[model samples]
Target: MERYVDGFVIPVLNEQLDAYREMASEAGKLWIKHGALEYFEGVGDDMEPDMDGMPMVTFPQLADTESDETVVFSFIVFESRDHRDEVNAKVMEDPTMDSDNYEEEMPFDPERMAYGGFRSIVSYE
Candidate 1:
């Protein structure tokens, strides 16, 4: 099966770092339970634009991040695109995935988040 991943970059207020971690941990567990092969989230330690003369698109810039905000990069892996669709359907149906409650509970602003789905082109054991 072709592997797929849904990646997200969220700008979180520095003071809410711990809250964001807790929220993400809960979401990750829920996603794994719904059939995600893997769920990973990481805080930014180095988020500078490339110096190699590239297009200069950094995570901070993509997230429209501010000085008081930090970047969070996350991904949920799936066995395949179809599997992703299936898992997401079940996840959304889960009671804990409620959007009304999510807004109040989430630690970051949804407007400043970046998200995308990708099919892995390469993999190594």
Candidate 2:
């Protein structure tokens, strides 16, 4: 079965958008080069959550009322979980991954970044 990697990123503020985008772009490229089947990024909108508690907008959603922070939802697809692990191992060891120079301006708290691997339950597309 196919596997996937999902990442939820929360940006610190609008000023951090460019740096975050650059980081995501470089990471996506590295993943693809290391064997990812697909890579994507979604920008958030200003819409609010619906009555069902689901947001009617994109990522970078407000994390708090007093904060300008927003989240970025991104993911990568792989042929299998094993492939995902293998590619990830290589990606981690690659020097390019460490070259993301925006360390000081990282949008979200690294410890809080949500990420995980999952088996494909179903895919329509």
Candidate 3:
């Protein structure tokens, strides 16, 4: 069966990477508790790759990151689009998400974060 996934790309200050990881770890737990199939948060260790002269925009370029910042790529998977919606709804309603420091604690600028939902077109495993 095909799956649904919510993906995100964010530019985080190098010094705030730890804080971002902490927040994302907690969020991942909440997502899993709310029925998400999988959660992953990866920091960009390699923002650019050699493409044999092919033109392509790198993660840093897409995120418009600076020398003091790096990119974070994350994704949460669900059984299907409907399942994703259900899980996200539950996650939003989760009391743990209502922290008073919600906005202040976020390590990256929300306006610069890119988010999207995708339907899997192929699965090999």
Candidate 4:
């Protein structure tokens, strides 16, 4: 079975990493409660890219991370595109997602965050 995913990458200030984790934890719980199969939030603690091979754009470069900032990569998985849509609809309506609250408490800059949906091409295991 194919799975769908909503992914995001955001650059956060080093000082705000802990606050970001708190927010991501709350969001993760909400997503799980709304039927997301899995929710992942990863902070870049060691983004040093090895130059042993072909170079590629890394999370730091992609998000233009600064020395005082760390990058966060996150995702929510669903059973399919329709399932993703359904879950998202519920998430939007949940009072826990109050826009004003988020705007005030967000740990990162919304305008600089990257977001997208993807369909899994292959899965092993």
Candidate 5:
């Protein structure tokens, strides 16, 4: 049973773009180095039509119009849920976690940052 960490990020201000990207990239690398089997990052773009006749998936739209225009998303996959938890605990304890350069510029409200751990229910490849 593989485990995954999903992070949904929205950059509400242009000023936070550079910092957010840097943080996401570095975090991906750190996860891989610390024990994650796979790491990936994705950015939202203009939606295109899909076969379903609906617009392609887009970032979650906030109710507040004042929200920023970009979203940064990333994930880390592990061989098993227990392994994932172990690695995550170590990652948190590692001194480098606190040294992340983008910490000061976290764009979203911490209470509102969307994130979770999930077990793989199915996979095609």
Candidate 6:
């Protein structure tokens, strides 16, 4: 079966990881509650990989992160593109997603965040 996913790459400050985690936890729950098949958010643990010769753009470089910032890679999965749209619409209407409820500003820079929707071309299990 083909799946739809919304991916995000965000640059977050080291100190704000806790806050980001808190927000992501709530958001993940909401996504699941709204019909997302799966939700994941992971912080950068290993930024520089030993390619043994091959060079490629890293997450830090892609996010343009500073020394004090780490990348937060997140994705939400759905059965299909229409399912994603339905779940997202419901999630947006949830009170917990409201920006007014937050005490502080967003943990990451919105302009630097990369977002995309994808359809799975392959799968295992």
Please state the error at residue 107 of candidate 1 in Å. Answer: 0.9
- For residues 1-125, could you state the per-residue lDDT of candidate 2 as single tens digits? 55665545554456676777877888889989988989997666643545577535334333331256666667888888788889889999988757584456555467656677778878767
The global Cα lDDT (0 to 1) of model 5 is 0.65
Q: Can you write out model 5's per-residue Cα lDDT over 1-125, one digit (the tens) per residue?
A: 44555445544455666666777787788888889888887765642325577544445554122444555566778887788888888889877877563447565455555677777778655
Pairs with steric clashes in candidate 1: none
- Evaluated at residue 20, the lDDT of candidate 6 is 90
User: Candidate 2, after superposition: displacement of residue 12 in Å?
Assistant: 3.6
Candidate 3, residue 101: Cα displacement in angstroms equals: 5.7
lDDT of 4 by residue, 70-98 (tens): 89999999999999999999999999887
| TM-score for all models, in order of appearance | 0.87, 0.75, 0.95, 0.92, 0.73, 0.95
lDDT of each prediction vs. the true structure?
0.89, 0.69, 0.93, 0.91, 0.65, 0.92
Off by over 4 Å in 2: 46-66, 99-105
Question: Which segments of model 5 are wrong by more than 4 Å?
Answer: 1-12, 47-58, 62-67, 99-103
- lDDT for each residue of candidate 1 in 19-99, tens digit (9 for 90 to 100): 999898988999999999999999998898458876677888888888999999999999999999999999999999777
Clashes of 3: 0
For model 3, residues 2-104, the per-residue Cα lDDT tens digits are 8999999999999999999999998999999999999999999867788899999999999999999999999999999999999999988888878764766
Deviating ranges (above 4 Å) for candidate 4:
100-103
RMSD of each: 2.2, 3.6, 1.3, 1.5, 3.4, 1.0
Greater-TM-score candidate between 2 and 3: 3
Worst 10 residues of 3 by lDDT: 97-106
Candidate 2: clashing residue pairs, number: 3
Q: How many clashes does each candidate structure show, in the order listed?
A: 0, 3, 0, 0, 1, 0
**Residue 120 in candidate 4 has what lDDT?**
97
lDDT score at residue 86, model 6, on the 0-100 scale: 94
